[model samples]
Target: MNILPLIVLFPLLGALILAFNPRLPNRLAALVGVGSIGLSALVMVWLNWLFYLGDGGGFTQTLWQWVTVGDFRMGFTLYLDGLSLTMISVITGVGFLIHLFASWYMEKDLEGAPGYARFFAYMNLFVFSMLLLVLGDNLLLLYLGWEGVGLCSYLLIGYYYQSEYNAWCAFKAFIVTRIGDVFLAIGLFLLFTRFGTLDIQQLLQQAPQVWQEGDLMAEVAALMLLGGALGKSAQLPLHTWLADAMAGPTPVSALIHAATMVTAGVYLIARTHTIFELAPFTLSLVALIGLLTLLVAGFTALAQTDIKRVLAYSTMSQIGYMFLALGVQAWDVAIFHLMIHAFFKALLFLTSGSVIIACHHEQNIFKMGGLWRSLKLPYACFLIGGAALSALPLVTAGFYSKDEILWLTFDHGYSLLWLGALLGALLTSIYTFRMIFIVFHGREQIHPHAGRGIAHHLPLLALALLSTFVGGMIHPPLANVLPAGPEGQYGHLIRVLTEVLAAVVALVGVGIAAALFLGRRRLIGNLMEAKEGDRLRRFFYSGFAFDWLYERITVRPFLFIARLHRRDWVNSLVNMWPALALGLNDLLLGTQNGRLRWYAAVMTGGAVSMLFLLLLF
Candidate 1:
């Protein structure tokens, strides 16, 4: 009956059970993970139904007082509102499906090593952390979730830690996120000290009052909080971690990039929309950064030939859309877009995973062609996912959500943002279809050894079907939670226009691929021939040296300083005083003798001096 505890406790219980029973059969362990997640998902669905029944009031369920200080109190509490409830549904619902898919995908991994239980353990723990993030009633609790997810990410990314690069990538992801978390933690402390409370609802109510009273201090506090959201959400400057996060398995990439972590930034902005409302300058910067990041990432996506890398760049670009919405104060529309993006993007990534596994680990598009005939299920899934992403019309999920965001940006006189977003949409369509055409439409450049089986195809089929129709069946209008837009009678017109634009974009993208790589053997050959051209190709392949720039600017400098510290010079000055103090202590001890004769001589000399002073007085 108590839904809040059940939501967090169930996965926690699963983690406990799996951690202890390490010897359980792989299938049985997977079943436990899947079944536990499924139960949690059902509970989430039930809660969603109940929440939907309520008029508009939000709900809070306080479990107990977690800690108490002299005059401060924090609790183990969960807040269920329209925003958090939507997040819960996505985390547990889609999360369960991903777990089910993983049961099959990870089986091969278990054949040589018994990591099945361990994998499930990580998944279950990841779900619990995500729920905490969404359901937390206070900033401290939210930070707990934030750190928890980062820990799970590190563990899962380095799941196959035998590889040096996997381990390095995992560490990079962990440390980079921790950099953002530090700012987030400081912001939380400032909120508590200034407001005397960590409760989110109370802060929202008080922030505006503090602002109206000319509280410069409070505004600075809010800006500090924005820094955290920017980093977590992968806004412009701190966005490099996400691109490197793709170094994990495809499933990890899907869960983190498409469905969960990347959305954290948007959720943070929405959760603290009150703060943004007060700082108009910060809001504008948020929008501008989103616009710039989207354009940059979209161009990079166009240049990528690796299937997963393309999806990774696309994710950065799409999250920019959410930030754009946030900048314009369309918090609800941003959230709506987030929901739809999760469904389709996850669909795309998982389907892409299936194709990779079928191809025996081949990743380059040039190395894959004529896959449509052999990989019918994956092909179908890709098409559906691509359609939704392009926002091709007829009331698909992405169309409704993305169209709303674009319209909101335009309505707010952010014509430039609208234009940038529209171009992003077009580029998204082109690159997606480019991968589709070159991989499935052109010549059969099959690998010498390719494996095809039912295990890989089933998940792809299920996700494909969901991708196509799930967008239409969910809640309608989504107006209750998001800001209310004007209700119009132009439903048919909207649908027609959206469909036409989406189709044109999709066709142009597909047509370009056909023209360049389809039947022109000489063109394709010559393009691949020039060794000098290879250097140019490599530049595109390397993300235009953005990764290198980050390393030189941030990563290398960080490591260099770390090495400098180990050299015992940068910090040796700090030790100088302590070392001098110790030497003085040793020197002072040598002057004191424990013998009675030495003590007597010193006492007699002091007494003689005292007598001389007394005579003078």
Candidate 2:
């Protein structure tokens, strides 16, 4: 129990080691990088044992006094309970798996140069940031950790810095997310000013007493936090950066999209559920945003050709589901889905990484085919991962977690939202299996080199097993920590029907994918070959033209204004002195030349001028 701080410190030390000793032997660097996270996961397992085996109550650990100003004081502290336990479990547990797989994925780079060290350094640092975020007892520490992950996202996403395109992708992610971060900063300030402290438990306790339900301040603060959540989770308007984040290496995509950064929003909202409870309108708004983002991202996934981008959109859609759960006050359910999601989504992304590597780094699904036989392990893992993602009944973990959200949405009387979610589930199956069938079922387009070694096989097999009914059976430690989910207002029969419908839609979607993609893909291919289909394809592929629309209304206009003001009065004012200095130097230069006679004349003229000035004075 006392060693809780060490969980964060281990990864921090690992990052520091790799960062400073950038020339460590390749295998040792891998050991430090992967082993550090492995150690943290080991600590998490022990902590889980102690906490659960004991009274199963929340624990707060104050490591040190962080700061004091007059009467205001805050500590560098961590609070753990069911919610955070579930989170750090995903972070260190799944994060460790991702790190191990990365060692195999990035092995060539490990032999190449210091990039291997830099990559692991950033990886360890990212895990540390995420741990601090989920475990922090105070809002300030959480924000510090929040911004830390943002910086890491920028570094890891722009890892291929030799390419200008990848740099812009990282830049885009940073800038878009920064907008939401500003709103979050202001929200924290609002909370601090209202309560005179930023400790999360204190704030949650004090908020309901300080503000009544539907209070304007409460609503505003909740809205601000939602702004931050949307951006970080890749929800509406701020979501454009996520798909392009695939420009980084596949492992980066897995770490960021699968279990860490994109899920932070769901964690934030769940952690601050009390504050949001006071703001009913904002709570409903959160649900609406989640619904819309899920539908939007799910549709967008259908049009993507690049394998990683497809998974990237799937990540956005899945986080949208988590947000949907949060909106419905299914707090535990949200974290439940979050943990289950971490397993299957990480599985999918890691498998996709191998697929990309197997095809000699080809990412387009249409460009590679008949892989089911060639890459047997990855193909099987993908099938299981894709099935879990699509929420196949009984056998898959996603069916358990995600189906609960749908059932709860109906129980809470959000029937319209339930239907939307059902539609989203259908979309989920179509796009997921669509990727599976296209890449693995068609005639061979490119031969794939099968992935080998324990590093690769271990994560796939482990996550695949977890993506099954076995992982779904893993109970989250959230009963004491969170409010209960919507109790069956609609009763048992309705719940059964809804589950049946959801499962039916999922299977139906898979059948549609098989019909469309398995045999030459001609029916859909003809549709896509048509002018209108191609246009729609481009529209969906462009993320419903959000980027295009943003470019015109936001980005291009801002750039145009920037260009118009590029040489504006401010710059002119700053430049005037330099221009004046340069002009004076040029005038002085005109008085002399390189010629010796010109220099002598100048010297004589200067002496005559000095004498004349003295006489005149």
Candidate 3:
């Protein structure tokens, strides 16, 4: 009777239908795909209302017992609380908007019914997996959803199967993330082995009793989980696959990379806060990774020429902030920023998609200019999203959530991390506006055509408003779900000063961008032409050459080993038994090749042998 299960079911059922009917008409396909997510969004709304109407506590639904073994049991169960509610609301709500926009965005990109239907099918499946991920009561179910999203990401990212480059990108994303998934799986195994159950609520309850605050197993488990988070969220070292992933369609970028899938890391960390709290060393490591990743990604974004790649690196940096919050124990604020980030980041990606389409598929920011008058909707949307992204003062939603993270970092005695965060913020502002200025403020390079219809306009306008201070007003209910953020001991003056500094840094970064990028400045050209500057540009443009380094270290070495084996030694081992069996089979075939005289002679010999054996016995 509960509507909670329906929130996940609707999209799944839609995916099944669309998958079975690939030849379904485009309009009808759109109806099924968009309508399914729309339905889920509606159910989320109804559930949110019911949650508030009730005692405002957690809810769990056990559909049935799924599996049982010696001293272990699992079930088809779902859990709901303030944390999951926010996640699902974002998944279904923002997800529906993305799907609606995709219906329009994909219209010209894809032709015929099969293409449309297939695209919708993948989208629906992804939505289903994402909902299941946030709703599952147990780690197994959550892992299922987690892997499901990864699979769909590959399929959707390589939707243009005709392009070999796109296919390889999908493969790269898949393989890179699989390494992280293996880490997550190992962590799950470690927890289950120690605690004897994968039920998340039970794990949280029992971990404290079973393990000391600094237990080795706990730290190792936490570390393994962090590995998974880094890969999924595109943090440093494991972050090479994300920018190449931009080869996919823009909707795929918005949905999988920006809005929903990338945030899974933050969700995983927050969901398992109790375990992380036990491992202080690992907890500090989380913050350090975040700090390093943000700075790396921030510098990388500044050098990008492609519009989408800049956004891609920016995503990595923002997620770094989320991880920073997680490390510093601002769990609620991290989730808060995640929610706000989904709003503005989705807006920016979608608007960029619009720009790409308008310019006849041109994505280079350097190639675009002075189209603000022609494409006013996208221009305005970009400005709003960019401001929010840069955390520009009180006017934008990012200011509220991000400022909290900065304050908490400083308030909790991590002043060095706070300083690093400020520098990252400055970089964020400059790179973000650098793209804005170069793309929209310079002379028009090509004629443009703006997208029309409700799908294009509604999602952008809605997200634009949310990117403002208005979206930050809807507070997440985390008082009971997460530990309270640390109290600011440094009186009112210090807190005010922290906020003021962050805002000023953001503004100053924007001013610097304007000075350099506006009017085709001589300074930037001179700098780019310099030997060191050009080298740095090339380095950053290649994402610090992490991909190239990985190629030499992981890919080439693997290929070399494969080549030396000449069919693989492991394959030889497996083939030995089959070869032996075939040889015996060939020997038997030789005996069967008998002439009449040969048959008679064989019979006589068999008789003589039988008689001689009997006599000897």
The per-residue C-alpha lDDT of model 3 at residue 141 equals 96
Sort every candidate by TM-score, greatest first. Answer: 2, 3, 1
lDDT of 3 by residue, 149-233 (tens): 9999999989998899999999999999998999999999999989889999999999999989999999999999999998899
**Best to worst by lDDT, what's the order?**
3, 2, 1
Alpha-carbon error at 129 in model 2, in Å? 0.7
Model 1, residue pairs in steric clash: none
Least accurate stretch of 10 residues (summed lDDT) in model 1? 476-485
- Show the lowest summed lDDT stretch of 10 residues, model 3: 106-115
Which regions of candidate 3 are displaced past 4 Å? 111-114, 485-487, 567-617
Q: Model 1, 1-617: lDDT tens per residue?
A: 36768989889989888989878898789888989988999898888777667775667888999989987888999988788888988888778777877776677534558778888888899899989998999988988888888898888888888889889888887877777788888888888877899898999889887675335665666667767876677767777777777777778778876788778878887887777677777778888888888877877787687898888888888899888888887777888788788888888888777777778777787799989888876787788888777676653567777777776776677778877888887777777777788787767888533334554555565556656657645652235444553343345665466456645665576566566656654664687578866666667667667778888988799898988777586478888899999999999797596888888988999999999999999
lDDT of each: 0.77, 0.92, 0.93
How far is 517's C-alpha from truth in model 2 (Å)? 0.4
Model 2 TM-score on a 0 to 1 scale: 0.95
Q: List, residue by residue over 1-617, the lDDT tens digit for candidate 2.
A: 89899899999999999999988887899999999999999999999999888887889999999989999999999998988988999999999999999999998433475588889999999999999999999999999999999999999999998899999999999999999999999999999889999999889999999999999999999999999998899999799999988988888888886788899999999989999999999999999889999999999999999999999999999888888888888888889999999999999999998998889889999899899989999999999999999999999999999999998988988889988998999999999999999999878999888889999999999999999999999989888878885556877888899899999999999999889888877899899999999999988988998888878998788899989998999999999999999999999898766889988987899999999999999
Is candidate 2 or 3 superior in TM-score?
2
